[model samples]
Target: MAGFLSSWPWENLGKYKYLLCGPVVAKVLYSRMEEGTFKEDWCFHISILFAVRVFHHLFWSSFSNMLFLMPDRRINHQGYDFKQIDKEWDWDNFLILQALIASMACCLFPTFLESIPLWSTKGLVTVMILHVAISEPLYYWVHRCLHRNKYLFTHHHSVKHCSPVLHPFTAANVTFLESLLVTAIIGIPILGSCVMGYGARSAIYGYVLVFDFLRCLGHCNVEIVPHQPFQTLPFLRYLISTPTYHELHHKEMDTNFCLFMPLYDAAWKTLNSKSWELHKKIRSSAGKEERVPVPDFVFLAHMVDISAAMHAPFVWRTYASFPYTMRVLALLGWPITFVITMMMWAWANTFLISCYNLRTKLFETWAVPRLGFQYFLPFAKEGINHHIEDAILRADQLGVKVISLAALNKNEALNGGGTLFVDKHRDLKVRVVHGNTLTAAVILHEIPTDVKEVFLTGATSKLGRAIALYLCRRRVRVLMLTLSTERFQKIQKEAPQDCQNYLVQVTKYQAARNCKTWIVGKWITPREQSWAPPGAHFHQFVVPPILPFRRDCTYGDLAAMRLPDDAQGLGSCEYTMDRGVVHACHAGGVVHLLEGWTHHEVGAIDVDRIDLVWNAAMKHGLKPVSSSVTEQQES
Candidate 1:
């Protein structure tokens, strides 16, 4: 048999070379795929499959690229990304490195466990329990060092930070060697478990896969858990870093360290000690950080952590450009974990489209000059749009008050006066407010004598139109404040017929963000609010009234502004906010409500202070927090 085999081994080898070869065969298969030589499935199904694959690649690839480049902020090919300025910044690098050094024992320690002489099954069980008890803590300490030390962070674990803005693919952004290194550190206990024969190899594999998946689950860029339980769960965080479990690692400095297991942290007190307090504090302040009303850094951080964790196991499910006979599912011998996969997919898809829209806003907005393919992507147009004429008609019909202010903003002040006042007046034909608008509008002395009631309806812009609609009611008398236009515009062509058309008189005047006129005065004879009589019962509310300042604002250091705010609002309130980050509704009469900043924690300031702040915001003119910020998917 040996002689016969020796003679024909070469023949067998040649015959099955195609099966045995590696990348070369893969390349050949890939080529056959493009040429249609494989004679695969029918054209339609294949086309659908290919399209899905291509889209998936692009989605994941771009997401990964953003996740990596955004966090590192090296100013490479993608230009400037703002994710670096998020809540915690990149804090995991240091922890993982420390884990690496200690992880060397991951391989060696297990050997020792295997070598331990054993006889009693009860003793073996005791030792296994001991191992479980000690294993996580050991891993915890190592993991903590990786996060806390800078040297370890830079050399060993820095890649994770590349995805400052974590995405699904970004989970595997770390060097493959580093992953192995991490596995090794944690593997020590796994090996010990196997060596002791307390748990079978299958158990070890389950532990490893499950553990790795948890680590990733914690790293997903999106938050998948509620703070209610995980929000309150302590000690266990270090044992197993859940979605929120890992996000804190990315948030504050030297705060949360436990990953995949929290017992060690509980014992050593290294777990996210400050997280609950900060979360509660912020939430109590606004009530909404917990409400999950808007997308914020916490949401982004959790998403990345989860995505990364889930990604580690499925490094490659489909063949790499090869038309292999069959594309194997990710799990090799293990039964399918469709539930887990579906859960990941469910969480992932929920926010994928939202993130895509957010990330691509610039392209869509800047492409207004181009029409080729950009038109198909409608992400940029994110809100209700109303024209100047239509707004006045709505005012006349809906009874919304229009309080047209008297002055042009700084931009228009640079231009000329008549153009600001009279020109828009002729265009709008509405009686504009004929008075001087002073800096201290909340003081109310700047108003003229005869005005009866002044409602700070929204601006003449699209967002303003929507805001005004929200404020106006059928029975109420409302004076519309806007850049005067000749015709009444409709909010929607098929808008419901307003009930009381008698009380509202729409007034258009060049207002904030688009004054187009220089210093406005009654003498200009062109565009004045014919509606805001000299003495009016009035109030002011800002448009997009979420943020405290503007995106391009430069008053002082603004904590590395989340520039081009995802959803921000700025205004010179009618008055001052007695306190910062509010909770209860303003006790004051006039308050500026930002578009997306719905809930804030209650503070000591009198509600009147909030009202004044809201008024001041309105005084500053109107601007949305994010012009492109529309309703988005969950963070």
Candidate 2:
């Protein structure tokens, strides 16, 4: 807990510096509104100022999106998927809607705070108190009613819910009616403040700006705010809504209806069920590398697109990039070109093309900020060369030395455990890693020493096979689960004689439920249907597993992996209290950074070199968080 506050590891100071733009632009508008400045029409002045506010809000929202850095879900769990709303139109629509609302408020509302007054301390305190007193119940019921009415929700309220994975712009995506209700709740209070002669324009603007920032933060996917205040003081949590508080609301929709304060939600018994556990995890994970800023490293990833057709971004970019004469010719010949391209691709494809920029930014985590850029590529199983080509170009664009392939990217690039892509892309200036080696290494490092036997799922898959071989070498008997008996037999025959017979095939996950350690290397269909034994550890390696793991079993994946004592094995990476050992894929990137290249063959998964890699991480300032998994893997 002490370590959480000892240092703040945010690295992307470039974005927050935009906050200054708000006030600077506001001052310019305020001067124009005064007697001697350009046209003393208060209405006109206020209208422009409203536009400025809308622009400022949009700027901040876009800035946050561009600097897509946040606490890794492995450290602090996140509810939103960053990739879902990456289209440029989504942002433009949000900004346009909010700007329209802001214009109305500035032009039509008679209660605009026009006069700047010296703040009296007592008056400020009174305003804060009155704000909650006036806004809470009004907002609470309005929010609840919006949800209760099917017509209102379907037509207006649901637009905001379109982004179940919340972002800053999500806070502004509400319908005009909902926005008006919010405005009225806020307006009446400021109108009263003016009637009492206590309204100071500076104080009002300050409060509004603060509210805007908090609202943006509440929707941010990252959870960095500490829950210590709620834990130590007890009453503070009810008063202030954390990002996780609102996130649970988006996730469940029935609970947590508070605007900024959680007081009403607490009193009404609408707080989320998982809020406490989630908050504890949030506060304790502050020191994770995801929360810190690593200047040199940036993670670029994409969700696996399983579609057969090439994504439209490539077509759009190609058409827009042509010279005027070529553009006209292409437009005239578009039907033929489209048909030819599709037919050729259907037969054989060579290059991957970009579909959209899902997230592009410098990420700030506990250690330092890394350049994090993510894009969507439609070529998941087909068009292998195109995918690899775009990856190289994107990495080069960011000047990143290494690029981590995620989901289908890993699947296609590695040929499901082969290094053909690396061999083919030998001329790429940057290193490409499948990121499976470190993940496998971390899972191997975390297995309990006392466990004599383990259950291995996805036994025929690339990752599963590697784990089976590694476990066999360690003399730990493995009960392997695979759909293909022939593949398992082939792997078994390759094992050392002493452990060859130790490997046994299991047909069902339920059959292996009693095994003490279950390594889920790939998704088994109808997953999470059979639960692991009560005390067993379930290590999940696949992303978006076929189904969520059963809740009762211990989550022994990277989110819970800890470091060894005294940071002996961790290299130069920074440590966190709750989340100790970072994800092995992340740690692998750090290892490459320290060594200046991919020392091992890229795209291959192995656990034999776990110690060397772990030591490399520790030497570079990485430390272990958990004392239990500290022992070196036995030879």
Task: Give Cα distance to truth, residue 72, candidate 1, Å.
Answer: 26
TM-scores of the models, in the order given: 0.32, 0.44
Count: clashes, candidate 2: 37
Residue-level lDDT of model 2, residues 1-635, one tens digit each, is 22212111222343353343354345457667665574433444444555665655655543343323343432223222223343112332333333344445444653443443646555566568777897877788888887877767776577687764566667865554566566677666555676687776555556666667788778765665777777789888777777788778888888988888888877888878787678777667665654433334433333222121111122222222221123343465456555755565465422222111111222222100111112223433344535555545555454656655544445633254325656665666567665565566666667876678888877776667767888888888898987788989998987888879878898877777668688877665545436567776677676543454556656553422333333211111121213234455655665665566644335545556655666676666555433435554323
In angstroms, how far off is 318's CA in candidate 1? Answer: 15
lDDT of 1 by residue, 508-599 (tens): 44332222111121121212333223322222232112232222221111001022233222111111121111111111111222222222
> Scored by Cα lDDT, where does model 2 land?
0.55
Taken over the whole model, the C-alpha lDDT of each candidate is 0.32, 0.55
